[model samples]
Target: MGGFTLDDILATRKPRDSWWTVFMVDPLACRLALLVANHTSITPNALTRLSMLIGFASAAAFTEGMLVAGAVLFYLSFTVDCMDGKIARLKGTGTPFGLWLDYVGDRVRVVCCAFGWGFGEYTRTGDTDVVLAAVGVVVLDLFRYINGPQLKRVKDATRALLETRLEGQYVLAESVLRSRPRSELEQAAAEFEQTAEDTGATVVDLQKAFHARFPWYDRFRVFLVRHRVRTHVVSGIEFHAAVFVVAPLFGAAALVPVAAVAGTLLLTFEMFLVYRVWLASRQVPRTAAEREKILV
Candidate 1:
């Protein structure tokens, strides 16, 4: 019997996926992963390591100016990359180390591919500009990827602090007024406070509390996610394939710089959007008490 059904593979997808990934690459990769699922002994981390190994091979091929070979290997590496998560979700074997490996492996792949492009172009035409473009690709892409998650971390921490501090004020009020309050409204408040004190919330819970408080923030997040199609092409494996595979088919290493420049510009715009969303999230009132009356 097959370890994964079609629905099981589909269930591993992110809520907001790029059109190319959703329609093209992911479906094919998931099907392949499902076929291989009967093997049972292969783990997600093993797939991750395998993907990284193939990624290094892709980089070496690019460095040798074997564009078509590099491109094919790049796509294969990416397909394997997608497989790791699919396998993890299929087997319920996702781990913190698996996630860490996936994230770090992605960064390593970017660095290797970037340098490969520079080295390949240098071997072809000896242009110093190729090196500069590689640097820009790494800088802009890393900035966009790293900053988005870090900003979200900041927002989570700030929201948690606000929830705790504001609730502390309420607790202090209840402690000081123990002798004076016996009305029906006060009894309800006391009960609610007791319940809140008993059930402590995590950072994620506080973020959800804020999400409930601000409908627009939730809507805006959805909007950003849905509108990411424009930046999707020059990201991930697609970027490498465009430069390494398609460029050589046309006999033009010039496409290397072109992709690097386009990726930089796309990521710059994405960074701006990320910053705007983070700013908007920060503008929301953090305290649930303050946000209770108005739906932001």
Candidate 2:
């Protein structure tokens, strides 16, 4: 299990590149990580555990008001965080357990960082708000974890619907074009045209009807309504990193509170995106047989 290489995961047909993977800069670093994994006996899980340890050390440094030390540790931990998954892929050790461990490690890292921020504040000004904000961050982090499975199901369902609809439409059109007799072909073409027209009209009518009957339904369209905002919010995580980088320039303890607020808000928005995706998925149709199989 742990001895497997990235080629094995690739054999499972996972996409080499995805939005999240691109955001993490995995593609650029994959080759280097692969080389390192191939020559080393270090397991991906060990890397994950090492990252957690580094994160803990970083938090401890922050709590002690050792800003420079804490920042360095945080960045190092982040590097380890990035390396673990790449190593897993490169080594073909990317098991379900390894994935689960990596995810759990990330959540723990965030929580530890939040707590470290609170500790830093306590060491400087004894403020309770920092601790409260840390707790809030953890709560939002849990929200994301809870919504994960639902979001996956929703995405899968949406992909299935689009594929099925496109395939069905193509087959119907081709069948009409390849009909045996001229009259039969003409008749088939007529039926096809009617279907095309009816589908178009039905979609337009449904959109109008839906808007008129449920004006609020537009809010449920995840990509249209929420994607940009979510992207912006998630991108703010880099801002937190920037703050840590420049902490020494701003000696004022007030900056810690500001960073805490920003972190909490970002985490909350991420959870909101997950929830919205899950809700949108609930609106998608499932197979009739599957539906019939439901006990309810």
Candidate 3:
């Protein structure tokens, strides 16, 4: 018998998705993932490998000046790429190796496609700017991805430190008040405290968390998510879709400008995201190790 229904596959998707995946990629990926998960013995790692091969083929198509083929192939590759994650989450078969492969595969695909497009157009037009645009694409893509993991690491560390402090606050509140906490934040921290004390386990989520500081931010996020798009409007997914899928329709002359505009938009959103993260960090007091690391 099959593992999951089509509805089950759809439910395996992220709580929120980027605009490109939500609108362009996921609908088809979900349907395909449904079929593969139910009917085939194919694994998530295998799907990832297949997606990488398709992506490489798309890059090759671009290099050969097959714009229509390249665009279709790239879109197809992305759809398959989306499917692997869904299958992994749905089947509980995900591994650290699969995650690493997916991340590295995405970077390789972008790099290959950028170089292929630039070289193909340059061969026909003799425009050196295309080469520069290609290089810029590689650098910008690397910049975003490199920062993302590091930022996530920092956020994780901050949360750990914040949790410890909240635990302290919870203990003190219990000793002193023995009643309702002062604020909503204290109310949540107190509850978490009681649960952990009863179970002797770790509690990760501090309700009324970092977002609670800026209530409007939560509302903004909900509003965007309600429309099926994440707050990051021009993230890596949108950047690739713009450069590879959308730009090709306008011919070689449009590629550089399209890539340039895409890069700018990506940077703008990314920097804004960094600023928001910094502000969120300020809400949580730093630990001694964090302070020392910053100094170094």
Candidate 4:
């Protein structure tokens, strides 16, 4: 029986997953676990399941009006959420299925938590923030679902370009290192350096070219290009969540306006991101064809 070590799982490069890493309390725990287990066994999926359970408990606490307990539990849930990927990395068991599971699990947690908050509010004060939050959650999920594949494609393209550049540089470096004649080697080394410099220049030039062609949409594209889990709009969503949490406790009618502003900002940002993504997708074919000849 082959057991998985933590190091193996952590080897997967997931740029999108890095945002959750910030929420973690003990970043090195997974690495430590890998050391103790001798790289032999443990699955990231298990940790993912555990995180989901903890997240559900946190949502339940919030629904039951245990604000302090709920906050603690939610933070714990977020921490576990960070650990699951780390555990996967340590165990070397990071499969596509596991990745898919983690993605779906995140959406489920968000949706369930939103619903729980809504239900809690409805029971307590017959307020509608909970319902609005639920709608917002659905909207967020819809945005993700619509853009997920396109984003993944873009990520893959970026990775390919980076890897190709690295490989080219490596080959050039090796040629310089294994020279039969010193003078020729020096010349080759200089050429290699020039090639590297040119490659970098080309990348910047291409970016500039892309911007020139799509000047109006370039800034919008840049803003929407979130490789990590860090979301610009989620900040607004979190603010709305805070409003919902505080309004009942304070009996403040002013929160309604605050909620409205936050919600509008979040939706506006989301819409802008979606539209930019659509525009970028439309531009991809032309960009791809131009790059193909250059790359070849």
Q: Per-residue lDDT for 34-132 in model 2, tens only?
A: 555657777778888888899889778777777678777766676666677766655566678988888888778777776776667766787776677
How high a TM-score does candidate 1 get? Answer: 0.68
The C-alpha local distance difference test score for the whole of candidate 2 amounts to: 0.56
Winner on lDDT between 1 and 2 is 1
Per-residue lDDT of candidate 4, residues 8-55 (tens digit): 535533443323343343345445444534543557777678768977
Estimate the TM-score of every prediction.
0.68, 0.57, 0.81, 0.57
Least accurate stretch of 10 residues (summed lDDT) in model 2?
201-210
Q: Which stretches of candidate 2 lie above 4 Å from their native place?
A: 1-35, 156-257, 264-296
The list of candidate 1 runs beyond 4 A from truth reads 1-3, 161-251, 286-296
Ranking by TM-score: 3, 1, 2, 4
Q: How well is each residue in 1-296 modelled by candidate 3, as lDDT tens digits? A: 47788889988989778989998888899999999998897888999899899999989998988887888889999999999889898988888899999999999999999999999888988899999999999999999998888778766656656666665332322232223233443465556667677654433332234455656655565566666677888999999999989897777878899999999999999997787667656656676775665423
**Could you arrange the candidates by lDDT from highest to lowest?**
3, 1, 2, 4
Better of 1 and 2 by TM-score: 1
Expressed as tens digits, the lDDT of each residue in 1-296 for candidate 1 is 45567788877776545545665578788887887686566889999999999989988987887767777787778888888888888788778899999988988987897789676778788888777777776776687577668767765555545555556333322232323322233555556567777554211222333344554654444444554333234454455445545555555456555666567656665665565445545643555665553323
- Pairs that collide in candidate 2 are 4-91, 4-92, 4-93, 5-91, 5-92, 6-89, 6-90, 6-92
| lDDT for model 3 | 0.79
